[model samples]
Target: MPIVSTSTSAFYERARASMKDLRSQAETLQAQLGSGEKLTRASDDPVAAARLRTLSRLESLSSIDTTNADRANADLSLADSAISNMATTIIRAQELATQAASSTLTDQQRAGIGAELDQIHDDLISLANSRDSNGHALFGGESAGNAYSVDASGNAVYIGTNSTGDLPIGDGQTVARSITGPQIFSFTDASGNTTDVMATVKALSDALKGGSTDPAGAAADALESLKQGIDTLTTGQTVVGTRLAWLDVVSERRSTLTELRTTEEASLGGTDIASTVAQLQQTLTVLEASQASFTKLSGLSLFDNLR
Candidate 1:
């Protein structure tokens, strides 16, 4: 009364084994596709999959932080370069003032010095309107346009905002990306003399062209103003350099953190392809042997000649 057919049992067992083999192959392929690697998915091995996901997220976060660091570095470099250019211009102006201050210089000689001063003034104005890598005015105080505009009387006037915008660098930290023109090159001296470097340069140019009436005294006063301007710009450059050095430290730290996170992620989610392939081969061999045995058992006849 018991169902006893060798072929039937063999067929059912073979079908089951075939299904298992197909499932294994499908899983391997899925792992390769998802992870762009073989034997690296959770579906291939749940524990490994979980670890890989965590690592992937951490890597993404690190990448974002790296982008922020790069931007900060670029901004700092631009500011530093601008400050250097300003320093050069200030030095040149000082030299010209010194030459004009010499009493031995005749009116004709003073006029020549005046012509060069005028050109230097033009250069300074151009520098003030200098643009950054992104084409934004370097000292415009966050305005996206030219920092200096020429008035009807040919005076260089500040048309930008009064504040230097700060770039956020994660973890509640921020870096000042620029210095406003008014802060760096415009000031009121100790003697209550309000002087805009650009304006002063233009005034000097006018005086020189008009003729050296009091060349020695005028040159002496201009020399002092030029010195003060240089000092102010130098201070700004020092501050920017300090901030840049600090940023370098922070950037290096972030890089270290990213490497650590990457290592941990690999440990959690990574798979050994060689080991997985070896196990798969063994499983297939066992399945093949079982099928052969089942086939032979189903072919046997207990009473072939009983009839």
Candidate 2:
């Protein structure tokens, strides 16, 4: 018969290694509980960590999109309000024109109407040069200053760009932030001629103030042109309204996407507190039992048995 022998040193080494492993596991679970995250570092879960990084970058970009959408919404709403006021002003000008066209009125009365028309002309010029939220031209199409400027002859001339420029809202989309001065005021007249709201009003004011042989005839002619100008303004209002609707749609979509991303972030990296705590308790219980067993085994000796 052959006897197999096991060294006491080997037994101690094996027992110490097992207890060390259990202690290391208990410390790791405790760390996870303290941190409130599943991953201690990128090395702990490389795939989950990388995915979290990507989600974080996407969140930052979404925040920027939200800001841009808000700015566009504000500028467009301002443009809509200004357009409505201008339409009201034009309607008042039409009323004045109607009164001036009356033959029953004396020359003096017509002159008084002409004076009021002059004030209206000035008001239209001021409206055209209205400022935006940034103190720049609202209808100037990205101009740093006013949209219209008074010339040497007191004519309001357009000094703005033709394009209002586009703003990026998100999800591969863009919106025109504003309408240009020419877009709101300029149109084709019945005489197959190019004319604008400011020019039409200025011409009528000049005619009524003794610049024409027949003031009544001039006022009648201006009525048709003014109607055309109103049409142009109405068209601009429709465009602004459509863009605002589009912004609302995009904003809703962005909100939904943001929520989805947030949910994914929580699922990928956030720790499950209830499950983690239970796991920690089980590990601690096993570690304590191993420690007690190791203490008793390490203290036992063959020498004591021989005595």
Which candidate has the highest TM-score of all? 2
Model 1 lDDT-worst window of ten? 32-41
Candidate 2: stretches off by over 4 Å: 1-36, 296-307
lDDT of 2 at 291: 80
Q: What local distance difference test score does each model get?
A: 0.74, 0.88
**Cα RMSD (Å) between model 2 and the true structure?**
2.8
lDDT of 2 by residue, 1-307 (tens): 9998878889888888887887787788787778767777899889999999998999998999888888889888899999999999899999988988878877788888888878888998898888877788889998888899999998999999889878888878899888998888999999899989989888988888888889998899999999999999999999999999999999999999989998887788777888888987888898789888878888988888995
Which candidate comes out best when scored by lDDT? 2
Error of 1 at 196 (Å): 3.2
Clashing pairs in 1: none
For residue 252, give model 1's deviation from the true position in Å: 1.8
User: Candidate 1 regions off by >4 Å?
Assistant: 1-7, 18-64, 211-213, 301-307
Residue 49: error of model 2 in Å? 2.1
True-vs-predicted CA distance for residue 250, candidate 1, Å:
2.6
TM-score list, all predictions: 0.81, 0.87
